[model samples]
Target: MKERIVVKIGSNVLTRKDGTLDVTRMSALVDQVAELHKEGIEVILVSSGAVASGKTELKIKDKLDTISARQLYSAVGQAKLINRYYDLFHQHRIVCGQVLATKEDFATRRHYLNQRNCMTVMLDNNVIPIVNENDTISVNELMFTDNDELSGLVAAMMGSHKLIILSNIDGIFDGDPNKSQSKVIREIDTQKDQIEEFIQSSKSTAGRGGMQTKYNIARKVAEEGIEVIIANGRKDNILIHLLKDKETLCTRFIPSTKGVSSVKKWIAHSEGFTKGEIHINEGAKDALLGEKAISLLPVGVTKVTGNFETDDIVRIIDESGKQIGIGRTSYNSQKANEIIGKNNKKAIIHYDYLYIEK
Candidate 1:
């Protein structure tokens, strides 16, 4: 069956060797995606290259040090980038919508759902949605440096079956890409701990994001049961090769053993995390996990730390302060403090709002 997919193309693949927009390559990619759409697959693209494309158009040679200069470049480049995509996709008679998002959008539940709605509406109308980080107005701390991370979140939000990241390299290497002995890892499986050692960090001049960021996002999305493939974008017909022929030399991260449903996966890896915590005794912890219900009774409550409001995501800790799980709270910090250590009237956290850690 045709599946929903999120494709992330990095700046290195979108720009020429001299930091110019590679129009030929961009057109080729859009063509492949258009073909996929014809096959009935829901395609969403997370693209990066606004700054680089802008730098080339304006002929600005001086280094942009200050945040303002970077924003100015992004402001100019983002328009040019989207315009190019608009022209390219139009050739295939495919309508596409542009969505520029910042970290703040995903940080709140309301904005997250709003963004989801916009994407859904576009897709429902048979229009492809092209997403990019709002770099022009977003500060460094509040920005997503790369499209790799953005693609993962979008995949999880749209309940996409797979996330395909296109970079300059073939795939994840065992060691540094510069090292001759580094070997490309074909597949990653149930072992998250074991794979950490092989992960290496490196940055791209054309883009601020690196290999490590891709690996981190891929791992997180894979945990949500969405397969993630990090492959080369520069290769001809690369997008079609992956979906049609599966003929790419990419690092494919498989799903974990404990398969989770799409809705459950979203709840487990919700965007905003709570700063508060609630500690439970061993008996309560087991009951929450085994029974899978929410009102955490005072009988299991051992301690409460941090101030959190109702519906906030809070960590569920054990008596010794180990985090056993995470769940949305049913009450505020003051109310939790009032009920902790006693079988009071309120259940601090109800069962349906909880996600016990595995």
Candidate 2:
């Protein structure tokens, strides 16, 4: 069977050099997706360019500051961008759904699972999901940098075998794309940190993410046991060439290191937006990490924090204020509070579904 794939096309590929929507390029890509779907391969697209499209549609005159420009451009661009994509995909007889995600979407465990379930159901129904960041309401752009991390999270959520990043450049170059002697890196392994010093910081038109950011995301997604390919989207038959030919000139981040499964990685990384926290004693921390197969006794819990319901993801912190692990809580905050520092009957975090810190 063909592998499930997630393709992220950046704004530079979807927009003209002057920052207007490139309808021709968009149509061509959509047609390629339609052809790929005919082969029975599932493809989900994470697209950018709403703000750039909006800027062209709105026809704003003067140069604006960072905050004002993003707020206005995103407000103007989001609907028009989706409408264009909808029209293009409609011609290909492919149904597309819009999903606007913020940093908080994957921060909480409940919201994370809900998102995963929603995408799974959509893919099962043969509907392609077009995901983008909610730039209008997002305030974490400075910290999150760009939607590269968002694309990785979506790929991990969908358990995709491959992630193709369609950008303007050919691939990762040694010196820079503008330089004549800059060599394209065809394969990247676990020793990517060695090439970190050679990477140059360069941003593209119509988007905030640069090559450096994409490289960072590629490294991260590759670590999750997913193959990541970075290539030029403007090239003709780019998608077809990538999937069919192994000799294609692209930076391929191979999944070399093996780790826990996708579910465990998700559980381990969900630190933000946790409803509650369990401060465990040192002995309990050791037991959880070791071969104890024991339920979390109340005597092991030193304190409980935050307001959470049953089955919410909570941090397992040690007495020294260090995070020991993350696990699904079996009881609410109030219930766990009552059982703290006592020999309780119920386990706060059961043995099953409980992941200890490594």
Candidate 3:
């Protein structure tokens, strides 16, 4: 099998300082991807720049409400973005497809499988698929955290060997980017590294995601046995450089030693899409995290929060109000409330549908 990889380009990398789409940068990136395609490496691109592109094109001086502004900008910008991609890819005699996805697409097994199949067909036909969140319609709960999160899910779904995230900054820093001495961390072992201290909570001017979001998604995907690289997109021939040289100045996350099942990866990545939460006692938490594969019983549940139906994805919280994991519930909120701490126990979440977090 050929080496498959997913490449995510941030809005900061695709837009100029004036907030307009950077045609030169886009062409350069596309050229690199075209070269990789010629080398027989399957590439799926997850791009973020629609809102910025739309805002620049509309030139609206007055401020609009959040939802309306996003809708207007994304609605206008997505067309321009895809059209540019089409023209650029066509120049290299390569066909590219646009796939706009929402958070709801990964909510269930059927929907996830459908999306997986679509991407599979596109790749099998030697066509590159450009994926982006449906920002025009997504609002509040329906929205993905950012394209970083969306790309992670897409990479996992496609069973890609690697995920390459392109950002404006040169990977992750040890301290702060503003500081001159804060050196870039070149390698990250997800199983051993404590990276929380180095990550700062800051959003980009042109995009919703920050360095923290990238770190999180990178760590999550790495845990599922996928290599993740965070590098500077503005650097000349960045993708090509990474492929040709292993000594590139980029943050590389090593995959976990233990492999995760496809179903478990889906469940683990669906934390943002959970509908409700279940609070369990220490004993239940221990059993789930321990050697024996055990189902969540009604007797172990102390409290249930949020109204959710059967088969809805929910977070499993410990008694201390910390999230331990997530799973598909076999019982609804009402039924779960009735059966808490009783001798007549029923499986609230079956072992097959449960995934314990590390």
Candidate 4:
């Protein structure tokens, strides 16, 4: 099988400092991806710049509120962005397809499978799938945290070998970026490092995500056994350089040794789509994380937080409210509540449908 990778280009990388679309930069990225394609590596791109592009075209001098302006700008910008990609890819005789996804699309098994199949078909035909959020329609619950989160889900969904996140900065720094003598961390071992303390909470002017967001998504994808690289997008031939291991200053996240199943990957990345949460006791937590694979029984559930139907994705939290895992329930919340503390041999969540977080 050919190696597959998902490359995410942030808004900061796609646009100029003045918040305008940088056609030259976009062209360069396309060229790098085209070269990778010729080398037999399947590449999927998740790009963010619609709002920035739309703002430049619309030139809205006065602020028209956050949500309304975002809707207007994204609706107009998405077309321009996709058209630009079409033109750029066409120059190299490479066919590319645009995919605009919403959070609700991954809420159900059917919708999730449908989207996955579409991308699979495109890949099977040697077509590059260019993905972006359906920003015009997404709001509140229907929206993703940012494109970083979306790209992580896409990488997990497609079972990609690696996920490369491109931003303006080099990578995660040991200290503040503004501070002198702060150095970029070349590698991150999620299991050992307390990376959160080093990340800044500030968002970029051209993008919704910050350093913290990238770190989080990188860790999540790496836990699923997908290698992740966070690098500076502004550098020339950054994509090609990283792939060739050409001495680049970037943070490489080492993938876990144990590989997760496709269904479990879906459950792990679908926390946003959870209908409810199940609070499990300490014993249940230990059992699920034990050496032997175990199913979640109703007796282990101490409290049910919200209403959800059977087969709905739910968060599995410990008694202290820390989320330990996620799973699809075989019984509804009401039924599970009724059977709590009772001897029910049937598994509320089978091992196959459960994902334990590391």
Candidate 5:
């Protein structure tokens, strides 16, 4: 099997000190991707440089709202961005396609599968797919946390063997980057609980994600049996070194041996898009969270809130309204409410469709 890898270029890595797009850096990264292409490695590039590209040439006369400015900038920048990629790949005698995605694209099973098929066909034809968020159309509260989150989704959806998140800094550190005592943590095994304390929550104004989001996305992607690497893209030939060298200065998240089902993987990323809430009793919560896989029965459901249709995504909550997981519901909100707290009924969410927090 051709090793499929997803590479996410962060805004910090693609943006120069002047906050403009770094054309030289961008070309260098594409060169490495082309190198990987020659070796028959299927690559998906999730890039973030549209806003910076917009800053390079355009100047707005009137002050605009944050969303409006972003929309305007993305509209102009995405065009220039893809054209550059198209030209660069063409120079290498490689064909590359652009895929602009929104959060809604992965909200449902059908949409998710449709995208997966499109990219699968592209890979089968040996075409590199350069993906980016549709920032021009994405609405507030509906947008992704950042491209890091998007890359993780794409990696899982495509069943990629590895996910490489490139940023400006080296990787997660024991202390602040400015401090002399800080050092890059080389490898992250299954000790995610111990690593949580090191992730700082401060976000960046440019890309909306920081080290914390990268770590969260890395952890989630690794849990899905995909190895994840967080490395400094500013360093020349970083991607090439990661594959060639035995030791690279990157934070590697070791993947889990257990495999996750396709439907469940889609459900895992649908936590933010659930249409309704299914509040279950303590018994059902315990059973679902237990080692043995258990379906969510209607008898354990105390309440069904919101207006969702059959097969829609729904969130499973505990008595205190804490989210336990998300799943594809077998019943609509009306029917689910009708059968709540009853016995010998059909499951509200089957085990196959349920994705619980680990």
Candidate 6:
């Protein structure tokens, strides 16, 4: 099988100091991707620059609201951005397709499968799929955390072997990147690494996601058995060096050896789309989190909160109301409430459908 990789280029990487699209930088990045593509590597690019691209051509005379401004800018910008990608990839004789997605697309099984199939067909036809959030329609609360979150979903959905997040800075620093003493941590063991204390909570001036968001998405993707790299996109030929020369300037996330099934990987990223909550007793919580793989039976369910139908994703809570995991329920909310603490009832969630947060 060919090695499939997902490269996420952030807004800061593609925009100039004057808040305009940096055409020179965009061409440079595409050149590196072309190098990898020529080596028979399957690459999916998750790029961000549409809003900044729109800013160059249009000056808002009338004051617009935040969401309106974003919609207006991105609506105009996505077209310009995708066209640039088309011309750039055309230079390399590569056919690239645009895939704009919103959060709601991944809300159900059918939509998720459709998205996966579309990208699969694109790759099968030797077409590079350039994915980005549909910022024009993805307004306010419905939007992704940023392209960082979107890139992770794309990586998992495509079953990519690696996910590379290109940012303005070098990588996750031991301290603040602005300070001279701060240094990038070389590698992260996703299995037991703890770097939260070092992760700063600062949003980028050029994009929605901060280093914290990148770290979170990286961890989640790494847990799903994909190696993740966070590197400075400002540097020349970084992508080529990372894959070809095995460069070490970035922070690399070591993938987990305990791989999950395709269904579980999707379930892990579907936390946002869950429909209801299932509160279980201490014994149930312990058993689920324990070494033994067991299904969630109604015998341990103390309370069923909200409403959800069969096959709907539900949040699993413990006695103290902390969310321990999520799973697809086998019964509807009404059925679940009636079967609470019943010994002979069917499993509320089978082991296969459950995703426990370790």
In terms of lDDT, the best-performing candidate is: 6
Q: lDDT of each structure?
A: 0.81, 0.81, 0.92, 0.91, 0.90, 0.93
**Candidate 4: C-alpha RMSD after superposition:** 1.3
Supply the global lDDT for candidate 6.
0.93
Tens-place lDDT digits, model 4, residues 6-81: 9999999999888899989999999999999999999999999999889888866787988899999999999999
In model 4, the Cα lDDT at residue 47 comes to 97
How well does candidate 5 score on lDDT at residue 113? 95
Query: Which regions in candidate 4 have their CA more than 4 angstroms from the true location?
Result: 61-63
Write candidate 5's Cα lDDT for 1-358 as tens digits.
9999999999988887779888899999999999999998999999999988876778789899999989988999999999999999999999999999999999878899999999999999999999999999987877998999999999999999999999988888988877899988888886444687787677765688999889988988888899999999999999999888848898889998988987778888887788989999999999998999889998898889999999999988998889988899999888998999899998899999999887
Please report how far candidate 1 places residue 75 from its true position, in Å.
Answer: 1.6
Which runs in model 5 stand beyond 4 Å of their true positions? none
TM-score of each: 0.85, 0.76, 0.96, 0.97, 0.97, 0.98
Task: Please provide, for model 1 over 110-218, each residue's C-alpha lDDT reduced to its tens digit, 9 standing for 90 to 100.
Answer: 7778989999999999999999999878886677757787888799888888999999988988887778999889888745445767766668878888887888788
Model 2 weakest 10-residue run by lDDT:
139-148
Poorest lDDT segment (10 consecutive residues) of candidate 6: 239-248
Model 6 CA lDDT for position 156: 93
Give the per-residue lDDT digits (tens) of candidate 6, residues 186-237. Answer: 8999778899999989999899999999999999899999999999999999
lDDT of 2: 0.81
Write one digit per residue (lDDT tens) for candidate 3, span 1-358. 9999999999999999988899899999999999999999999999998987788779778899999999999999999999999999999999999999999999998899999999999999999999999998899999998999999999999989999999998899999988999989999998789989999799988889899999999999999999999999999999999988999999999988686778878887888778899999999888888978788998898999899999899999998888889999998889889888866676998887888886
lDDT computed for candidate 4: 0.91
TM-score of decoy 4: 0.97
lDDT for model 1: 0.81
- Please give me the total number of clashing residue pairs in predicted model 1: 5
Q: Which residue pairs collide in model 1, if any?
A: 293-351, 294-350, 294-351, 295-350, 295-351
